[model samples]
Target: MHTPADSAVAIQGLHKKFKESHALCGVDLQVRQGEVLGLLGPNGAGKTTLVKILTTLLKPDSGHVLVNGWNVTADPEKIRSTIGMAGQYSTVDGLLTGFENLYLIAKLRGVGRRTARRNAEDLLARFRLSGVAGRPAGTYSGGMRRRLDLAAALVGSPPLVVLDEPTTGLDPESRLDTWDAVGELVAGGTTILLTTQYLEEADRLADRITVIDAGRVVADGTSDELKAAAGNRLVVCVAEDHQLDAAARAAARATGVTPMVDRRARRVEAAASDGPAALGRALTALEDEGVQVLEIGLSRSTLDDVFLGLTGRARHRAA
Candidate 1:
């Protein structure tokens, strides 16, 4: 929940369009101060559009957007000064060294030369790019360049940071580093609005998640809440190849739902409200029916399952 004073960014009935395509449809969002709110969806879901509106880069066709208590349309400059933005693509100057890149951003933000240099060095050190601070961004690895770009965005130390798919192309290790950096920023009281296609990233970092689809917010809540709303857990067990179908039928009869068979592993899988208890009952049913169960276990639904259940499309499904 967001109170007026606790909100760092707020949107009410936001709408936008490009010819026949509606980019946003009466979208509403609220970001509380010092919280990381993840905006998640497939491509063209309007995550970037919402970030642009909040950052004052693009105007909404209708509705109101406020950042740090200032209306974006009427107070763009004030809002800009209080927020930092890093887009999906790295924006660092390729010819400039890491330190130079940060220094340039600090200068552009109106910091004096002495202060800019200090800020640049401090950020480079904090992001663990100090050793490569002298190397041109073009010469750095993908991970290092990303770190430098993130450092540049933080040179102003704004209260809110907007990260749009900030780890899109990085390796797993680099992504973890970026996650650590974001965690540090939020721990120090900076609010973050992260737009990402990665469900695991959102599950790991976001205090709340907003899932947008076709330019509208279809779902919004903490991860657990969303999972609960999506409903049902599935328990699976492997049986002998000859008894697989029989076991599945027995489980289905016990759970009152059709069991799915995994031909490759000779497994029986079924969905139920209570996974553990359901698994126990399923095992008992199989045993009573003279069916042998090789292995069985209960597991909670994943964010992927929730996404598929809500959107009728897997998170990784093509747009």
Candidate 2:
């Protein structure tokens, strides 16, 4: 029997549906205590539905979900009590000051008035929102709002935090700040279930990743494991625009596969098992053929590459 002392989250044969469309099909997942698990999928891939079920906002059609070792179906309140949620959009109250928002949540969670004030102040400082704690959340910048939303979720100090695309619309600086915050949360022994569109984010934060497509799990593994499954490749960029075809020929010859060319980027890419060695040979071949190369690099397959290789579709659009 599963217990709160073991896994943070455990699911088996989970299924959910909307009208005739099935959202989850026998989905099973496990999140180790104090580990960050990245849940990845394209839009409309049942990610939202599954998160809802875990948060006790929606009921699954069938199967079992245990959160913090409490069955989601049988002891929803117990599960809910241990979970903190930060959704895709900011849930901060626009009219309320940052400190007020967190203070309110603390009080609502049954904290004493003095303790609530202390917690709110501490969270504001921790999230780098102390400077803006007196400002109305509506008047805050995008990054500030996101930080406030995240801080608010931790008011009760829940053991499991569910972050749904927490950095979706933030600037690079803000995203990094959020990443640091997540790291701190984990360092403090909090487990996180993160769903995100940014492969880089998952690659950085997750100890393990679970990928779903069309409402079904397509892959699950560590970032390196997933990348290895996608395979390694060489990327070569020619100096002169006219040298593109020559570079492509070199890449193909070195890798024993037809190289893909991007004319706009003046680049040629091809899969290579030997990575650096293949890239070295490809460069030598290009040099011998008098193809002036501007730049070249060998890269292992990335999470984006893994998603493309598995789902045959781009996960994130240019935004």
Candidate 3:
């Protein structure tokens, strides 16, 4: 039996398909209690399908999914009782006022009338929606609607929360607001499973990340770990038009790697195993070759680089 001290969400040999399109293929993952696990993939990578199965909205064709020690298929009701979810799109009722929406959910969850009212008010305040709590949800901006949707999900104070692209289509400020709200939830001991297209969001929020590609698990690790797996850092140098070839040769010699020259950017870049030490050597080589450096910098692999390295394609590339 799983416990709160163990995995909050676990899947083994999971597979799902819709007619000819395979959504998940032999997928396996575990989200530890009180930890944020980011699910990342390109479009059609089955992120939404996985979230649906966990929330009891969809049944997996083949797999074992356990939520807080309860089998998803065998005890869906029990699983639902422990999870809160906010999807990519807002689930808020357009005609209902913000406070009314939250109150309705609280009441449905068997909260007392007085406690429901208090919870509704507190949620509105927490989401910064109190000023317009009486207004119809349809009248709110995209950001406000998202905040309300997330607040509604938290009305029962569930121990597990599933957030699927919760910050999609929000302004920068509102995205940060949602990030702060997520942090608060984690602080209160909620385990989160987040699916997002935003690498920076995953970097900032998730303790670990699972990346899927072509309906299969391609990579899983902490941000730094994945970045490290993407291979060595690179030092890039831009040279004056006449010195471009010379700089490229110098960089290749310094790093002992083939250099890629960007004609449009007037830049030359080569992988460097020694990071700053490689940069020092490259600068010396450039000076020896009489290459006039316009700009020079060392850059480590980012999550994007890691994703591309594993998937053989960029995240925005359609599956």
Candidate 4:
């Protein structure tokens, strides 16, 4: 039987609106205990709105949301106390040093000063920020500040951590560091609700992913399952940009799915469920259309392919 202990987060028939525009439409998703749930959507896909509702910053128009088994409407305070949140923007005070940021948060959570100090030290070490633990957060590098922000979120050791675009603007190295920290959190049995537009993040971190677009739940599964459901990608690279249109038509004809056109790359991609047959058909269509094919292949579908197939657009990823 489904119960509070089984799901760290649960939503049923969720709906929300801002004036005439619908922000969420009967969306439902769940995060299993001690697992990471990646929430994926394009901008304005009700991700932020859902995060707000889960964090008790906004109330849903209608729906049942349970966090750690406590109803959102009946227990906002309980939910807040049990879940830690880190947004795209850092919430740490610039004036506070790394240790101070964590220490203060621990204190605010009602820990004794001595215990808060210990918690701060432990977190700084865990995130590899102990070397600059005394430096003001504003003076830290972007990555360090982000690490500190993450540390602050864990001050009270909340069972569930909601991370929204946690690595949005980090350098590749810094992003890796943040990802490592998240992995550590999971290893320690913390449940994570991660919302990110970075497809790679979802692919690597999420135990299960729930994709929403245009205010509705569109897809949900493990990364491999979503990719498998997207079938294979029939990719064609024409010799010239001018051939893109014909190539798109050929891919469409070959796969019976609309093709994604990349003019700059002189590439056309489409989902091909029948890999061998689709490749054969594409080759014929290209030859018939007098298109110069530089490369043609049927490759396994990627998470990005699954995302595009469901949402009708590519997710913009950070470098």
The best candidate by TM-score is 1
- At residue 33, candidate 3 shows an lDDT of 89
lDDT of 1 at 160: 88
| lDDT, residue 313, model 1 | 80
Ranking of all candidate structures by their TM-score, best first: 1, 3, 4, 2
For candidate 1, the 10 contiguous residues with the lowest summed lDDT are 230-239
Relative to the true structure, how large is the alpha-carbon lDDT of every model? 0.84, 0.88, 0.86, 0.90
TM-score of 1: 0.91
lDDT of 4 by residue, 1-319 (tens): 2577899998999999999989999999899998999998887888888998999989988999999989999999999999999986899999988988899899899999899999999999999999999989999988888888888888889999999888888999889989999998989899999998888999989999999998999999999899888888899999988889999998999999898898888899888999999999999999999999999998999988788789888887655
Error of 2 at 319 (Å): 4.2
Winner on TM-score between 1 and 2 is: 1
Cα RMSD for predicted model 2: 2.9
Structural similarity to truth (TM-score) of each candidate: 0.91, 0.87, 0.89, 0.89
Q: In candidate 2, what are the lDDT values of residues 133-212, reduced to their tens digit? A: 99999999887888888898898899899998888878888889889888888788889999987788889999999998
Compute the lDDT for candidate 2: 0.88
Please list the residue runs of candidate 3 whose C-alpha ends up more than 4 Å from where it truly belongs after superposition.
1-5, 249-266, 273-290, 293-298, 317-319
Sort by lDDT, best first: 4, 2, 3, 1
Q: What are the per-residue Cα lDDT tens digits for candidate 1 across 1-319?
A: 3555789988899999989999999999999988999998888899888888999989899998889999988999999999988888899989988888999899999999999999999999999999998988899887787787778778889988999988887888888988988887877788999998888999999999999988989999999998877656555565567787778777787678787788788877666776567777877888877877777775566788777766678776322
Error of 2 at 150 (Å): 0.8
